[model samples]
Target: MKVLIIEDEKPAAKRLERLLLSYDDSIEVVAKLDSVKSVIDWFQTGKMLDLVFMDIQLADGLSFEVFDHVSITAPIIFTTAYDEYALKAFKVNSVAYLLKPVDDEDLSDAFAKLNTLKQAPETVNVTAVNSMDQIAAAMQMLTRQYKNRFVVKTGEHIRSIAVDEILFFFSREKATFCTLDQGKNYLLDYTLQQLIDMLDPTKFFQINRRFIISLRSVKDIISYSNSRLKIVLDHFSEQDVIVSRERVNEFKAWLDQ
Candidate 1:
């Protein structure tokens, strides 16, 4: 089987190559590409391949842009860091996706699905085979459908809080709440985990398991003992929000980005 890999991170690309070779000696990697422009150029060559493993977010832009510019017939298995809720839509709508830090069992299962597809009797719809459009649609849905407002009830009076007015989300006494700029906290129905998947990663970050903070909410950053970091938020008076030691690097990267 001839395979192509499109991933921006060199380490991830190399790791995937090693995993593929280890899984099946019959598989041959045709090429590895890093950006949307390079992929479009590769597809223009009209080189036929058995399969393609791609990352959803490339260095230049969304990998979906490749479909708009070039024609590709080979089936693709997307690799992403997105959560399960967003990924579940891909299987039902079109292509298969594996979560990042890809595992042996999942890679094996993805290969198995490719085999099943080859042996299936009927010809799969070109639109549905790759489901490129569906994948794009799902990606759009994830970014677009973020909770814009929340309704909170207080003594038979209900008020809606706009997402833009929120400062941050934190867990208190086993319930999740969003703090407003004015320092009011209202309980929310969703868990911090659910909100992490839904809220825009660029805007909100899960600095700790209990806290998902917005960029605008950060008042100051202080280096703490043992190499951890403390976060001060505007109008948040409960306690200091600490970024766990293990999460410090990723939290920094998110802030820098």
Candidate 2:
């Protein structure tokens, strides 16, 4: 099988190639390209490829933009760092979606899916243009719905809290809670993972396993031990909030954006 890999990160691209070869030594990687422009240019050359492993976010822009400029027919398996909601969107068109740091088992599963699709004549004949249209429709669906407010029950009365009024969300004792800007905390029914899909990425970020903080909630940032940074939020002094070491780079990139 001839494969083309489009990934911005060099290390991740290399790791994917290693996994592919380990799975099947006869599999040949034709080329590795990064960025939307590079991918478009490569596809225009009319190279013969059996499959493609693509990253959703490239250096220049979203890899979906590549389809706008060129038509691709090879089966694609998307590798992305996006949460499950975004993965659900990609499933509308791609052969399969794999989360980042692609596991060997997941890779095998994706290949199995591809083989099954190839065996079905009706499924194998689906054009790439139709897939592109479905991708656009899925993205529109994802962007149109974002939770604007939450309804909470306080005693016998129920009140709605706007997302702007909340400072942060945290998990303790397997229960979730949200703190307000005015020094009030409320028990929430949704878990931290659930909130990741509901909340907008620009406003809320999961700094660590225990905390998902808003952009306005950051009052101070102090460098902590072992390359981690301490986060200080208003009205939330229950514990020290620290960005985990693994997420440090992504946290910094999010802040810069």
Candidate 3:
């Protein structure tokens, strides 16, 4: 059987390919395409495959954009970390959804279903577009929502702290942390990477390796070397907050906005 892996991360793509190869020597990995541009280029050359393992969000844009530009007849299996698009993904009867870090059991199950369907009569499911629209709507719902914040404990029970009472976020030793204006700290469950993705970028900016400062908490900006800027944050001081040289433009744009 032939398969194609469409993923952005080189390591992730290689990992998936390795897992699939371990499943069966017969499954050929036709290609590993990374960004939207590469995928478009592949299709432009009239490339086709029996099955495709696609990621939802590509580096350039969404994978759904592929259908917008190309006419593909083969089936698709979406491998995503996000669960918001399940409704739309099931529209095509031959379609499947596999979450990331796909295991052998799941890959085996999908392959079993595909083999079964291949032997049966050919059929087309027309509710695909409607389901796709539903999936899109679900994604919109997940874009942003703020819940009432409170203090969470790792070991000891403690009184709750309001979200507004927090001053700055920091990452230490690969784990993210939250600090209140009063100098108390909490180890957060979310990684700084995931937090950056979810945090309202308009209100929170990753000023440096260690901090994501709130716009409301920034007191003033001080000039620093190499066109970087140092920021003074209200109720938060210990480490001098400086914007890295790489992020100087983004910091300026965030301030201007």
Candidate 4:
């Protein structure tokens, strides 16, 4: 099988290539690219590849840019350090992926699965426009106008809290408070729904109608009854933050990613 590796880090790219060779002596690595531009350039030359191992974040920007420039017939197994939401989201649109520091067993399993699917009568087809739209939607969902700071009024004084300092947001008796890492809460002018539209999806996940917890703030996640999940935050003390049953799978995928 001919494969291409697109990872920005030299060490990572080299290690992945070595692993690919180790997995199967007959497998050939066609190329190792570090940036979207280089990969796009390579694809434009009309060289064919059986599969591609791509990294989400590249040297220039998000690797999603490559889909905008090239039409790749080969299936891509994306690699990411974080951003599980995109992984799950893309999988629905026919993308395979592995997390960073690629594991030998996982890599082998991914190849095995691909090989198995290759034997099926039907083939997966992600045309240029389809791939572009899927990737664009995922990117748009994850990264759109996230607030870096919020202005809160305390008594007669007003202060700004950086989004990084926030642990979570909670609603109680018709009031919304922004809890910080230092265990302080400030009332905000917006609602949880509004916060959902404002915060970065990678940084904050809206567990339910009541709360949106930051990744840095999560202390633990416990499986609950009825296929639900209970989230514990570092300094959150307001209520039991639970992931609704309908959202359990997505919540787990986000947490694990």
* Tens digit per residue, CA lDDT, model 4, 1-257: 89999999999999898898899988899988999899999999999888888888899988788878878878778877855554555665554678788989979888876776677626644322137667888677545567999999889999989999998898888999988888999999998998887887777888888888878888888988998988888886557788899888877777675
Q: What lDDT is obtained when candidate 4 is compared to the true structure?
A: 0.81
In model 4, state the lDDT of residue 108: 89
| Per-residue lDDT of 55 in model 2 | 88
Q: Model 3, residue 66: displacement in angstroms?
A: 1.3
Q: Is 2 or 4 the stronger prediction by TM-score?
A: 4
Q: Judged by TM-score, which candidate is best? A: 4
For candidate 3, give the lDDT of residue 235: 68
Per-residue lDDT over 1-257 for candidate 1, one digit per residue giving the tens place of the 0 to 100 score = 89999999999999999999999878899999999999999999989898889898899987877888887788888888876555555666444688899989989998887677667637543235456666677667555667778888777899998988989999988999999989888888899999887786777889888999999999999999788999999888678789999999988988886
Candidate 2 local lDDT, 1-257, one digit each (tens): 99999999999999999999999999999999999999988989988899999988889877877877888888888888876545555575577888899989999999998887778858665235237667786556444578899999899999999998999999999999989989888999999999987888767889999999988899998999999999998888778899999988888877875
Alpha-carbon local distance difference test for all models:
0.83, 0.85, 0.72, 0.81
With candidate 2 superimposed using the best TM-score fit, by how many Å does residue 89's alpha carbon deviate from the native? 2.5
TM-score of 1: 0.58
Candidate number that wins on TM-score, 3 or 4: 4
Q: After superposition, how far is residue 108 of candidate 3 from its true place, in Å?
A: 0.6
Model 2 quality (TM-score): 0.59
Candidate 4 backbone clash number: 0
TM-score of each predicted structure versus truth = 0.58, 0.59, 0.49, 0.78
lDDT of 2: 0.85
Predicted model with the maximum lDDT: 2
